[model samples]
Target chain A: MCQLLGMNANKPASLHFSLAGFMCRGGRTGEHSDGWGAAYFEGHACHLLVESRPSANSPLARWLHEQPLRSRNIIAHVRKATRGAVALENCHPFVRELWGRQWAFAHNGHLKDFDLPLRGRFTPVGSTDSEHAFCYLLEALFRRFGHTPPPTPALFEALAGLACEISGFGSFNFLLSNGDGLFAHCSTQLHTLQRRYPFARARRIDDGVTIDLGRHNHLDDRMVLAATAPLTEDEDWTALRPGELKYFRGGQDLPDGVPVAAPLLLAV
Target chain B: MCQLLGMNANKPASLHFSLAGFMCRGGRTGEHSDGWGAAYFEGHACHLLVESRPSANSPLARWLHEQPLRSRNIIAHVRKATRGAVALENCHPFVRELWGRQWAFAHNGHLKDFDLPLRGRFTPVGSTDSEHAFCYLLEALFRRFGHTPPPTPALFEALAGLACEISGFGSFNFLLSNGDGLFAHCSTQLHTLQRRYPFARARRIDDGVTIDLGRHNHLDDRMVLAATAPLTEDEDWTALRPGELKYFRGGQDLPDGVPVAAPLLLAV
Candidate 1:
């Protein structure tokens, strides 16, 4: 199994603080230490850093954990290599381009014999079940929508339906994003923390580090975090139910222009 | 226009030395300075760093310029936007995946009113004509050869032909690599320097920096570098003729197993 960490903030924010604790899970605290990867989106482009090395001891990972790179949306994964070899290509999160937008995906569970046929358009560069699934999803989405990008509600519906179908194979917990919005689905495990106004002090679950989130804000803007395991202990973390799919944008569960009674409500 | 620098080495080698001189063109020594980007391929995965800010002043670019990350194939570009807005997506060294391999391309020239229709699968995440041309090239290649990757010689023929057609539109000097081989096509301006045994001291053209290449060598392996402009003052830089398309792999002008009399000879 692998670990996933994501951040969606209203303003451009750094992930170094949380990344420090997340890197510990790669080898120091837990055992998802085969390889690690992270993608930082700056508008439409993504800065990808992937290495086939344990994060706890890798100098590159340490530099990233200490770097102050900020992004509106970020996704990271530390792999234990359930399927593919411990190579750089097999690291997550995997990226693909669809509808002129870069989409990224990372999974934490295995899909038993998930042999889905793929079109020549979107194929996997890495020999991993997760990459195969990501390509399949994008292939299906492109096939359904053709050239134009689908409306957000329509896209959410299509993705949720596809997630439900894939969940039948096995555990399919995953986090995905396309710069504008993030989509997370759970089959067995996934947890999230929503940080808004009147932020509270948070304590790390892996290490004994604590930080006060209230002192660094002046706006009502919020940030949402998703991870396969809880990174903090003091804050309230909400775990996604089995077969549940959620879409978040600009740190809001339902961002602007989406109806509250939209079809995405069916996901939860 | 943009400036491109690509390195194809037998062993994993660092680009920091060449990058130091190349980055100077982004803002200091010359004025390609709208934005800059570079992609380093480690195994089948590509580590891409792109930014809208000028490479000379951006902290991230400075860090990358100073880092010791090494790879067999590296492609870097410093862009002066000719067709697109100054944004992250508009930076050069665009990347796409084909035949289960990551392929990166960086252009140094412009195409006048060049817009080709995309087949949805490998659409451009950015609005630059360079990216549009990249998608078009990949779409055409996929259509020509369905699922399997074409051989190096066959791919060289197809790309040279396509490049000849695109060059008719405007200047189209570019560098492309698929982790296995590096291809550079000169529509107007491109130069290459091959470094082998008995290396001599090399002097930087941007800065009066000199380094003894012999001090770092023991084996007889070689590295071939291609760039838009000459990087060193003391070495002989061979300029590729207009309409020439050359290929290199493992630091060789012609890799093993290819008949020297193949159609690629037309490129010479």
Candidate 2:
């Protein structure tokens, strides 16, 4: 189907090992060879790259593997087209702006009867359900709070509620962020791992590569990793329970009992 | 938050216009600025690139905007860390393999307690729940049908079921593929658009730029684009329902009631 990879850490880190292995699915080891994309966040700025070539064996993919790109937060994807024809416009890892803050998103499932609603202010450039969702979410946010972002707890509660509501219609596993925190929700199959002190050696299942976090990462740094499935052989990954959503900041989950914001309707 | 952009067409297409606008979110217009990445799919492979720099002004991002990279399918992402420590190891759009096919995925949400019981067969190289979920899906597919991929209908049904099972945890919106077709699921936010005859000049919502797709695409070629939000200023984007999933092949949805090999796992 598709694969997703995300990392949250207390310090700058590189996804070279994970990306190297993930690239194999672009063309070498598998056939999601539609296109690939990735994003890395550095404070209020980000670096983005996109291509319509397989990542496993593509020159670009190879170069990236050796480039050792680093960031405190990152999101990457390889695509297998579901809607949109196999064209550059239909790739994954879409980015947008809401309340002057940058937001990123990637998806792994499909939706039914997804029609673009003519939401005021926010509109879509491409023709995909993923974009519609993003627009809708932001439109709702803007509708509820105008230009100011709500408190983290309030925002989280609202987002979680909206996510849960959206999940009822179809599969809605996704990863979202706003430079302040990373939010993840699993509808069907998603997993996560937190790496703290005592990092260990990990072997990639797709490419059979191994790396020790202790050697690669600073010991004091804490990290959280989430994906559709496990990619390493040595570490333990926890699967998300049905209808569960979590927020991470500095690699730690936020406490519960956050006040929820009022729901905003999609702009039409 | 995170963003994804994708294009699928019968022939290769470039994402210059869309990407140009998306890059602004890295730092110029928005803030998904943890990192940036993109990939292209050609035949049975993908070409990938990632940079841990601000895409809005990154030399590489600007180069890509001017350099036309063409492909039949594409994927890209911009990230803001909420989980794993800020590092390259925690990137989105993780790729993997199963049944001798490459698979790619990106996410825009977070999963809680996503650490699932992962066997040594499939593991995560990064520390994102998104990758873990991807591996689990592949592992289940491999386990269900062994090495040889099942028929398309059978495979779709199985994967769809798996998607539903995982969605129970949280939001499970995603896009998946194996060179044959694309599978997408919506848990919260997802959008899709199809462009056929009567192409028009579309403007980027993020960058205030415009492009005439009719000049770049052929009358005979149709395309579908998916994203986290609409990139263009004027376009219709369908929003995915909470629990909806679908597949697209050559810019068309799969016929309904096509003997799905597995039963829809409602319980999951």
Candidate 3:
């Protein structure tokens, strides 16, 4: 098992506050201590930092917590290494380039016997079911859309369908982002929180640190956060139902693009 | 023009000492103050850090100089923004995945009116002639070798030929690596230094910092370093001829895979 965290903001924002609490799950509060990774997207480029060490005490992670690397989209993961060796390459949030955009993906749950054929186009650099699944998703998208990117709605639909199909193997809870949007899919467990103009006080669940969210945010700033578990105790975190997919862009949730009434099946 | 630095080692070595001097060129010693990047390969995974700020004064770069991130292969660049805006995406070294390995490339010189048609396989996320040339090289390699990577000799030959073709547009000095090997191409300026058993005192050219290399290294430790200019004051650095390509693996130079007598011409 692993813990995943994602953030989408209307303006370039730092994940330092949330990351401080979330990273506690890597060793202090939780058992996901094998490895950890974080990806911060600045336009089309990303700063991807990963280490095969517990983030709770890693000097690099500590340095990262102090630095305010602002980004519109961010994804992070702390791994427990259920599927692959505890190596640097197996650390999540894995990244790939698709349609001239740098895409990042991170998984929170394990997939059982998830062996899918890759079309030799977006192959995995690491031996992890999560990476294999990410490659499959990219390959499927490339095969369907060719060189040009489809509209956002169409992409959301295709991704929802793919997520549903992949969930059939096992738990496939994941968060994916390509700088423009952040997509989160729930297989068993996932939570979301929204922060806007009327922000209030929040308290960290891992440590008893209190912070006035209003002091750090501007009036126009809007943001959405997704995590496997709630990082703050005071915030109202919404739990997504199983097999649900949510899309967020510019810190606001887009209308439910996937039909929620029926189960999605990727048409081959 | 930008500045390039690369290292290939027989062991997982830290580039902190050399990087300390090399990053000084970002603003302290030279005028490559647009941006800077560094890529360190840990097996198939790469820690790619890029900032659209001068490395000499950047806090992140300062932290990096203090940390000992060990790797067998490393590439770093200080950008001057010859053909692209000073953005994070435009910073080197650029990275892409192919054949289950992460390949990193950094270019030092500018390409004049270099617009080549991409085959829609590997696309450039950033708008730079350097990235465009990198994508062209990858696409050409994929077209020639398909999914499976060719032998080292074949790959060296293919890359040498591609380097020659790309250099026709302008100066294209570059350093490329896929963890297993480091390939350097010289259009007008490139220098290499070999350090092995009999290490001696070395002084930085940018700063007058002197260090006894033998005190920090073991007898079996071997490394090959590539830079646009000699980083140290008292090292015997070899200058590669124009249109010449050099391949290195395990910190040692391989035989001239391409015939030195005749210039390479990539067949369409």
Measured over the true interface residues after superposition, the C-alpha RMSD of each candidate is 1.4, 16.5, 0.9
State the lDDT of candidate 3 residue by residue for A65-102, as single tens digits.
88877889999999998888999889998988888889
Ranking by DockQ: 3, 1, 2
CA-based DockQ, model 1? 0.67
Write the candidate numbers in order of decreasing lDDT.
3, 1, 2
List per-prediction Cα lDDT, in the order shown.
Answer: 0.85, 0.70, 0.91
lDDT of 3 at B120: 78
- Model 1 TM-score (2 dp): 0.94
Q: Which TM-score does chain B of candidate 1 obtain?
A: 0.93
Per-residue accuracy of model 1 over B1-268 as CA lDDT, tens digit each: 7899999888988878778999988899988889988888988878888888788887777767667788889999998888889988888788899988899999988898887677676877778888988888988898888899877778888898889988878999999998877899899999999988878799999987999888876567688999998999889899999999988887768732243554454554
lDDT of 1 by residue, A1-268 (tens): 9999998888887877678889888888989889998988988878778888888787778667666788889999989988999998899999888888888899989999999899777778888889998988988888899989989888988888888888878888888898987788878999988888888888888887898888765458588998998898898899988988888887878632264564454554
**Clashing residue pairs in candidate 3, if any?**
none
Alpha-carbon shift of residue A200 in model 1 (angstroms): 0.4
Assess every candidate by TM-score.
Answer: 0.94, 0.52, 0.95
